[model samples]
Target: MLTGADGRYHWPLPPATYTLTAHCPEDGSGGGTGEVTGVVVTDGRESTADITVE
Candidate 1:
């Protein structure tokens, strides 16, 4: 997991619109793959997001 400027856990991906996703660490939780979230950031702009680990 990655920490953002927002002080939240997330995954930093390529700067661009993406189908951001997060999944369980195979801890046998049905919450595998976090809720679908999306963010549209320019190639050279700032972007951030927070995701909850089930």
Candidate 2:
């Protein structure tokens, strides 16, 4: 999924622990990748994970 202009993305998944990763392609300038591991999501609750790519 792609993030909006604010660099925010939304994805719904079944309640469980997961590891998420995000990557930005290098277009000559620069690019990087980030990952968030051991994320927990519960029913009727919201989980937030902030990843910063270098």
Candidate 3:
């Protein structure tokens, strides 16, 4: 989990399929959610999964 003032994050993991989800709170009610699925991370490379909640 990530928490702070910055809206950026990063993670390093082994080669595999992964899923990333991001959520943002709105007002005082329920929040919004975004997800990125089937992210294939390979060896000796960089993979990006950007999620935006609006």
Candidate 4:
């Protein structure tokens, strides 16, 4: 996790291709899943989608 000034997670990923997905791991939170496809490298060059988990 990228730390913000408050030490909070600002961004969840780094430069790389990924199958970005989100799901509630908790039982009561409910089960859900989503995918973001073809997320290409997006850093070090105008910050163009170098970090994604879709």
Pick the TM-score winner: 2
RMSD (Cα, Å) of candidate 1?
4.4
The TM-score between candidate 2 and the true structure equals 0.87
lDDT for position 41 in model 3: 94
TM-score, every prediction: 0.47, 0.87, 0.66, 0.38
Q: What C-alpha lDDT values do all the predictions have? A: 0.60, 0.91, 0.81, 0.48
Clashes of each: 2, 0, 0, 11
For model 1, how does the per-residue alpha-carbon lDDT over 1-54 read when each residue is reduced to its tens digit? 645575466444566666566665565565555555577767666676555656
Q: How accurate is candidate 2 locally (lDDT)?
A: 0.91
Model 2 lDDT, residue 8, Cα:
91
Candidate 4 lands at a TM-score of: 0.38
Cα error of candidate 2 at position 41, Å: 0.6
Badly placed stretches (over 4 Å) of model 3 are 3-6, 26-30
Better of 1 and 3 by TM-score: 3
Candidate 2 lDDT over 1-54, as tens digits, reads: 989999998898899999989998898868889999999999889899998876
Query: lDDT tens digits, residues 1-54, model 4?
Result: 333574333344567776645443456656555456676656663322322322
Q: What shift in Å separates residue 2 of candidate 2 from its native position after superposition?
A: 0.3
Ten-residue stretch with the least lDDT total in model 4: 45-54
In candidate 3, what are the lDDT values of residues 1-54, reduced to their tens digit? 674577767677899999887888777867889988999999889897778775
Of the pair 3 and 4, which is ahead by TM-score? 3
